[model samples]
Target chain A: MDIAILADAVERGERRAVARAITLVESARPEHRVQATELLETLARTGREAIRIGLSGTPGVGKSTFIESFGLMLVAQGLRVAVLAVDPSSKRTGGSILGDKTRMERLSRSPDAFIRPSPSQSHLGGVARRTREAVALCEAAGFDVVLIETVGVGQSETVVAELSDVFLLLLAPAGGDELQGVKRGIMEAADIILVNKADGDLKATAMRTCADYAGALRLLRRRPQDPDGFPKAMTVSALEISGLDRAWAEIRDLVDWRRAQGHWHARRAEQARHWFEEEVRQTLLAQLAQPKARSLMQSLSEQVADGQLTASRAAQDLFASLWPEMEQTKLPESLDATIDTP
Target chain B: MDIAILADAVERGERRAVARAITLVESARPEHRVQATELLETLARTGREAIRIGLSGTPGVGKSTFIESFGLMLVAQGLRVAVLAVDPSSKRTGGSILGDKTRMERLSRSPDAFIRPSPSQSHLGGVARRTREAVALCEAAGFDVVLIETVGVGQSETVVAELSDVFLLLLAPAGGDELQGVKRGIMEAADIILVNKADGDLKATAMRTCADYAGALRLLRRRPQDPDGFPKAMTVSALEISGLDRAWAEIRDLVDWRRAQGHWHARRAEQARHWFEEEVRQTLLAQLAQPKARSLMQSLSEQVADGQLTASRAAQDLFASLWPEMEQTKLPESLDATIDTP
Candidate 1:
């Protein structure tokens, strides 16, 4: 619990300290939250950073396989690797993506690699928020590369991208129609698209899919953040491990290009600003997410859904219900109450 | 200022009252906002409802022309109609979509039709939120149909979809690749895709484009909220005033189907719930959007951006600054401050 000692241990890359710090960040207890903030603030002074890569894939697209192979490869090169999964839908699916570290057995066993499952079991927004903190913890612990993996559920992939310097999309070999299923926001967010399972029978199919996306990417006017021939699509095979080296090389090239263009620092700063703003917004919303106010919202929403009350009227009533709570706060008198106490 | 009188006037379909109510909703003054909430709540009791059709098209796609023609046609049918524009990009573009009444002069002058431009010039979120209230005002004023038009900017169209009973997408004659330029989120949010400018030499090309999108729609699995043939694509010539009848008929058919399937009420209830929750969240965020808190956030964000402070550290400091403000409120002491004074 000693902030300085824990930060020093994290800087020395002590695995226990790293795990404990991550656990601290994940805790929802008020006192723990205070300590977590203190710990993070202390570690921030260390100024350590890692290549934060965000990886997203469709369900059953071999995401775990990809991360395992990818993490192992990084660790083998004498780089400490951390794999963190962010699955906001885990509670509903009853299958946490990284719940069984055995999925990444080899990587988990690697002394140079660290693996963690999704932080919160539910609350779509909080899972990704907590994962962002975990990524910072990994960076402070001296990891050379941190792979943040997320399934294409809700907005997890987009949230993961905010925590990452590089965003990678892993897709299975599919036709154009399947490509249409991919949300364009995520496609535009990707720095690189990898058509995975590109070996054996599906090799040619994966190549064709890659070509389709590559062509699509080519048609996209160059984003100011990226260089030419960048944001390109390629095929990869996690089982055969054939295309990873090239993919890694391409990632390095993109990172190097970005750094040379001074975009690396600018981008990190922008991401930092984004997260700070997001933290502020999320804190505000969390007030309403608390048990008392949530029940009131639910009851009022039921009235709305039943046509017993209009949405506006229900909203006004709820807003009025929280006035007493707002009165005691130094909030501007103009502040409108939202979360209602039971 | 009189909530009951205004609600009564609105229900009577008085144009002056409708416009005044909308302006009240748009005003950010504390007193005006309180009055607006009261008026909306009173109006909600009337239970008057209108079909809200969301319309979206790329700039230069003749959206205004389409709306004008479409609005005139409905007016000709003796149906009372209201046209509301939600343009979040108005400030930057310096050209609000419905700013010039001359753009839809004929429709505007029609006794049965009313047109109002975008409410907020900037602040993307507030524009659409205010427009939702405006739509409610229109509905309470006994308009049979309300057309919500938005340019393809940010998430305006998506927001419009939530406020609409049926969502329409208007597009110029273009190839399959151009379709790729359309965000898939908007594409899927659409109920019908109309290939505008389907007259003149572009007729055949429009038909081809229509066929291409129709084919794509066919490839998509049917959304449960829609019928089998719905969300299909077709060609329409807004200039020629042709195809408007068919489009209206298709919309009625879709509405009738959804109504019979029980999805219509369910959808509205869900939208109400969504808006209610959004109001709560937006209220919380509004606290920071105030002058003092916002300036603090800006300065701290600059620090984070300049790398003079880590994002977490800056966020922590900002959070700390907001605490004294929080202590005055009955807010659960759980809220860490997130905004600071200069």
Candidate 2:
């Protein structure tokens, strides 16, 4: 119940306490939000100097396997690692498997690694909200690095891009034709492109795929002020733990380059702005769903559907009947007078 | 210009006049909206009866080519066809090619077919809005079939699905693994999936791809209420018009089956409800962007970004600052008491 004490424990690098803090923040209770805010503030003061990385791609691209290998490598280097894996929950239910632990069993057992899988609440905003908060919690727990992984479904990639310093898009070894099938916008957003499952028979095809991707990358308008110097293609076998060190080296170099260009700070600031706007949009939607407003809107909708009234007219009527009255009661005399004077 | 006069002309099967009327509705002027409402009122009284079809797929999926051959085939069937193609627009300038006429050159010259291409506006709502209104206008012009072509992308498919009776998805044959990679959500939403460009050297590959897709379709959960039975996979060469007749036959069957099962009316009713919700959401977003609220919110955001205030506290402050206090020249206590009681 005492969030301050729990937050202090989390800030002191007590692993179990940090996990507990994350759960409290993730709780939907109003009281939990108050407690979560306190925890975040405390954590913000003493969070780790971790390099946060985001990994995203189409589903079944072996993201879990890659994260597992990458996290194990970091642990082998005598560094602490944190993995925040997000999975979108079924809309009918507010829960998910939270299954990243099962995929990263070895790394999950390591003393220096922490793996947390958070359910992506129905909307993109919900997922982004918790992930950012969880990252802060992990950092506060003194993890040397944070890896956030999400498959390229819905707006998950965009959410991950906003929260992390580096974003890696894991592509399968499909050729140019298949690559062209994907929306260019998603491809353009990637900081690095890693062709996954590049071992065994997929090796030759993977190299060809990499070449095709590299060629396609050239045709794309160079990213504006790209901090990664130049985007490079790499073949990696997450299943075999091969070519990962090179991938890690490339990620570090890109981060340092971005930091030098001040892009790292700039991106975080942009992310904050995006979060602000998204919160406003979401909260406004929630407010509109309040009982009185919702019932009236639904009734009018039924009428509109039955051809009793047109849609635009119904909207205007709702505005005239409800909102105008609310506005009249809301404005102070001084404010009204100021408007008249103007 | 009198919209009622325009509507009357369109109702009388005046094609040029109907096109002009739609242009007016799509205009960004207050007077145009007033005219559009008058036109809609007149058209609504005419008892709309038209088969509205939605076609969507990723770019380079030969959408235009398919529509061209399909529309021409419908024309030959003694049906008047109207094509509404929504193309992507440049965000900076709001300029677009409106190139369907060029792509569907044969259809453009056909006496029984009408082709209109509109720029997809910056707002997805704008695209949905204009497309629906245009369909209504085309119906008023005595077009029996309205084919709406939308660029396949996030949320666009959902938008297209809401406005049409029959939905078709065009897919490319990526390779042997193509069936495995395609998103099941899109496939499920489709009433028919057409493997386009299934001729020339691509013929053998196309047949194989079709078989794979057909096999994959079996694995998906069947819609319990598909009156035309389950969704089917078909291969067509949009350029050569091969299998054009079969695709049209399938489309016609689905539309008739939907009408017989009363699915048509229910779909329209559901669409109207969705449209109503979308309008309210947009209105709330606009209200937040109003000068007073925007300024207050901006100030609060700066504080939150600087870490001088918690987000929750900043929100309360913004809400308080934006709401006008209205304790003006007092109403008579009797009236005030009466109003308060209500």
Candidate 3:
């Protein structure tokens, strides 16, 4: 229950203890999260200097192969690598499959590599939050490089980008025409684009696709952080492992470029702000689900649906009806001011 | 301003005026929606019997063409038809570059057929509340065979199914492994599968794809309703306007089967319940974004992020803090009680 003790253990490079500490933070138990948060604060104070990179692509895109080759390169350079590969389907029933440990078989067996496959909970955003926390845990456990992999579909890219310093979007060399399938909003968010499976029959198509992407990148605005960082589209074969060195080199170049321009810290700070807002939104929404509040909403909804009243007027009535209960405790001034405001 | 007056105009078959009125309902303005909903409710009472069918497919699957051809067929039968097509990109930014009106050039010119295209909105739910209201308007306007065409990607299929009695999934014969890309969850939800573009070089592939889908359907559980109704997969050429009659016939047969078993009304009732829940969720979420509440959430978030608190405890604190004001309004206990059960 003592988070400070866990923090101490995590700071001492105790791997098992660090993982356990993260598990505690992720625990739904009220008491455990409180203690884990305190431990997180302690870890934050130590200032973990890990290079967190995010990798995402469509399924069967050889994400595991790429990560394995890239991670091995990091180990070869005398750096400890930690991979947090998120399997969105693994936890369809609210349980962790821990399949990343199996999928990244070679990486998991490596002494320098720590691979954690996080469960995608009922909320994908929750999975992202817990993964971010685990990243911090990995840093406290002495890993210098952290790679987070996510599913290519839906809002996973945005979620992964929230916790990463450098975001890399992986693509297949399905030809330039297939690029239309990628939503522009998601494409705009990527810092790097990799054309994977570039060898064999895909080689010519990969080159062409990469060229098309490079051209498309010009139509988009340059990233705010790295004015010099052009979105680079490169071809690589994860199976052959030919471009691992170049990929790692480019990533480091990007990190250095971002750090030199002060964009690295600025982005992290922005991410922290984003994390704060999402956390508040989720927490408050959950609170709204409390029995009494939910019942109030349901009845108000029926009244609105039955044409007896307007939604805004019903909201006003509910607030009026529940005013006494709301006024009981003196909330923090910031919160109080917000609630008090019309 | 009088909804009853608008309903009267709609019932008199004022097409342009009714179209404009439906547009107003889909508007974000509170007053507009209030007026629009009132107009829709009045129309709901005197609704005509419309063969409401839902059509959903991936982009470039010729959804507009299918609707146009289908609408023309109904018009040939001396029946008026209404086509409501939803374009997602148009909804988000309130703009449409690829005009569906222009795409359905012939249908737009039809005196007995009405075509209305709605843009997708910021709401995650594909069909807007106003879209439902517009359906009622079309019914009041004396249009039979209301065909709702929804974009292929995302959860739009489920949203479209709520407003229509029959749901159809359109597919392109995509290579030998055509079914591979069709997600299983979505396939399970479809009532009918129609392979479009089934002509020229694609005819053989389309037939094969239809056979594959039929085989797949056999392995799945029989639809809860219509035990006698076979889930048929057909090949059609929306462009050539061939096999559409057969598709329509099958649809009518399914609808008739559902009605005979009394599943049609039950499905609509369930949809009504879903609409109620969705409306409540949207309303409550909007309320939380009120200027004051947002600021409070922001402040609370920072404190939580700083490890001064856990999210669960913070939520409890927020609710406990707001209790007095909520209690003062003297709302019924049923609000909270109802929420607890759903």
Name the top lDDT candidate: 1
* TM-score, one value per model: 0.82, 0.71, 0.65
Best by TM-score: 1
Error of 3 at B331 (Å): 25
Question: Considering lDDT, where higher is better, how would the candidates rank from best to worst?
Answer: 1, 2, 3
Model 1: lDDT to the true structure:
0.80
lDDT of residue B26 for candidate 1:
74
Residue-pair clashes per candidate, as listed? 6, 5, 37
Between prediction 1 and prediction 3, the one with superior TM-score is 1
State each model's CA lDDT, in order: 0.80, 0.72, 0.69
Clashing pairs in 1: A328-B328, A328-B329, A329-B328, A329-B329, B319-B337, B319-B338
Candidate 1 structure quality by residue, lDDT tens digits, A1-342: 577787788888888788778777666666667777777777886678899999998878898889888888887788999888887776533254345577888888899998887654545256655787888889888899999998878888888888888999999999778878778789889999999999989999999999999988887768888998888899999999979989999999999999999988888888888877887676666767666777999999988778777665676677678644331111232213221111
- CA deviation > 4 Å runs, candidate 1: A1-9, A59-66, A92-100, A169-261, A303-316, A323-342, B1-12, B42-46, B60-62, B92-99, B171-183, B192-237, B250-263, B302-320, B323-342
lDDT tens per residue, model 2, B1-342: 656667778887776776777676565444555566667767877776788888887788888888888888889889999988765442322223345577788888897888876643435355666667788788878899998887766566777778888888888766975565555667888888899989889888888888888877777787844753468889999889898898888887887787788877888888877876776666556666566777877877776666565455555455455543321111111111100000
Candidate 3 CAPRI grade = incorrect
